[model samples]
Target chain A: MREINVAAITSCVRQMCMDANYHLSPDMQARLFEAAETEQSPLGRQILEKLKENLEIAAADQIPICQDTGMAVVFVEVGQEVHLTGGDVSSAIQEGVRRGYQDGYLRKSIVRDPLTRVNTGDNTPAVIHYTIVPGEQVRITVAPKGFGSENKSRLFMLVPADGVDGVKKAVLQTVREAGPNACPPMAVGVGIGGNFEKCACLAKQALLIPTDQQSEDPQIRKLEQELLAEINKTGIGPAGLGGTVTALALHVKTYPTHIAGLPVAVNICCHVNRHETMVL
Target chain B: MDCRISTPFTKEKAAELHIGDMVYLTGTIYTARDAAHKRMMEAIRQGRPLPFDLHNSIIYYMGPTPARDGRPIGSAGPTTAGRMDAYAPTLLDLGETGMIGKGRRNEAVRQAVIRNGAVYFAAIGGAGALLSKAITSAEVVAYEDLGTEAVRKLTVQEFPVIVVMDSKGNDLYEIAASKYCTE
Candidate 1:
């Protein structure tokens, strides 16, 4: 069995959080540049240009690309053969987040209670998802999710008869409503065929698939292309000032579900779409 | 058309601006987000004075990251103005003249813009690092406990924005879509 100290995880998480916030992933950058070149609206093109410039500034200055450095959403895969030592794994993860936010100078956006509304101050207790797999390594993906688009995510439960068209309509409606509020030139993560919670997780996972990639499944890939084309047709454009490119990518992930139900989840992400991964 | 303007957003200045105008604004503006706005509203309900007078001042709906390297602020950009829709009209009614944010405003805010001769401008969303260069200085004015959500007074130079809702009640978001829309 491979033995790993929880402290290593803590240090790794801290670095990932800071790194993800400061730099836009290369694939996302490539897509944004492609959008800037192709966008037809003078205003949309200008907005895209400014966004690209912002990305440059963040990287050079080593600062967050956006003020909402976002609440950290962590996805961890642990090998069953690995042994975790030296303190609770959960607390170690939270400690990593606290230090990252405090030291990296990222914004602390979490609140202690939903209604009473007190600031958590350190951006702690990340929304963590874990899976146990074979092998002896631990892989972690740190996605800092901004609320501008997170607030727009939705889950729908449909009868099996509703099928693909129903899913299309739901996604389009969500995109239309999101409009400027979501920060245009967006990435859409979709989950299909799972139950309520599973679908939401699927949707969130879809975002981690490099923004420029296509799904391996032919059927899901076709739907992704179709949705991207239709969404850009809405003329939401860059910054929703109206143009031809509203969404940069649409990704879909699916899992088996109950015979009677078809559940769909749409998790929208702004162009920033910050994430970083580490394996140890 | 590109227009250069300074603060206090006086009557003559408001009249000179229109929807769809690209504005480079300078001088003083105050920052507040959802929590700070709520506190301002609560203070009003208790018949107390606001931390800063709304009269002729522009309010930016923003919360910034903690500044490093002796900089005045960090990655300061506009948040969703629609989230502040509830408090905007009241703040307008109290003599606010200009607002900066991203996203669509509700009808009440549109009417308030017309009623109070105010203007709303959309700063490019997700362009926080670029936007911060324009903010020459920043200092917290109220609600220090709110951290990034604290009310701050910012001095800006050539801050870029597009006039979305004008004093004449024209909303660029309402019309910009049709001009560049695809079938």
Candidate 2:
């Protein structure tokens, strides 16, 4: 069995948090360039140009791409063959988050309460998710979620008979209602056929997929394409100033649900979809 | 499209802007978001003088990240405008001329923009790093206790923005969305 030192994990998490905030993934950059080429509105094209320039500036200056550095979210995949040493894993993760926010100059955005809202001085106590897998190394993925798009996320429960059409309608409606608030050409993650909470989880997980990649399943792939078309038709455009391409991509992930109910959830991510991963 | 280059905007200067025109802003502006706005408004309600003059000033709805070494600010970009809609008309009535943010505003804010001769501009929401380059200097003006939410005075040069709502009732969001939002 392999032993994973808690101190090492903490250091790794800190680095990942800082790096993700400071840099935009290459895949996302390429996709934005592609979107700029295909965009029909001149204003949309201008917005894309500015977005690309922003990414370059962030990378060169080692600063966050957006002011809303977002709340810290850590996803971990632990191998059964590994044992943790040195410190408590959860505490270590939080310590890493605190250090990263402080050292990297990223904004501390988390608040202590949702209602009566008080700002939590330090952006600490990260939201962590863990999954056990068969391996010797642990993998961590960090995605900073901003409030603008997070507030627009929605979940719907439909009769089994409604099927895929129902899912498409719900997604389109969410995009339409989101209008310019979520930031367009956006990335959409749809979770289908799961329980209420699970559907939301799956929807967020689907966001990790690369912007240009297509689903392997033909049926779901078709749905992704159709949803993309319908959403852009809303003409929310870039920065909601109006354009032909409102959504850059639609991602769907599905799991078997209760035989009687079909639950659908849509998670909207702005063009800044900041995420990064590391294995240790 | 009409283009205007303006600096250190005055109320009279801002009144000249129209909806859908592109403007490049230069000189000093201030940054504030929900938290700072609330505090500033509260101070106003209490009949206390504000830390900075609201007359003829443009407020950018943003809470920028802390600056790294050798930098003025971190990825500083616009946040959603609707959230600040609740407090904006009050400032407009107080003689604020220009506002920079993202997303759409409510009807009341839109009407106020028209009635008060104020203009609302939209900056690319997530393009914080690129936007920061335009900021030559930044320092806290008030509410330093609020951390990133503190009111900051920023000097900018050739900062790019599109006028989404001008001194008229025109709204780019409604116009653009309606074209493609076919039932």
The reply for model 2, stretches above 4 Å from the true place, is: B5-8, B179-183
What ranges in model 1 sit over 4 Å off? none
lDDT of candidate 2 at residue A35, scale 0 to 100: 86
Residue B104, candidate 1: Cα error in Å is 1.0
Q: lDDT of candidate 1 vs native?
A: 0.92
DockQ of each candidate relative to the true complex: 0.81, 0.72
* lDDT (C-alpha, whole model) for all candidates: 0.92, 0.86
**What would the per-residue lDDT of candidate 2 be over residues B1-183, giving only the tens digit for each residue?**
656566557757766776677788888889899998998889999999887888888999989898877878888889998999999999988978889998889999988888888889988888889989989899998999888889999999888888888787688777876765544
Clashes per candidate (backbone, < 3 Å): 0, 0
Model 2: docking quality category: medium
TM-score of every model versus the real structure: 0.99, 0.96
- Shift of residue A45 alpha carbon in model 1, Å: 0.6
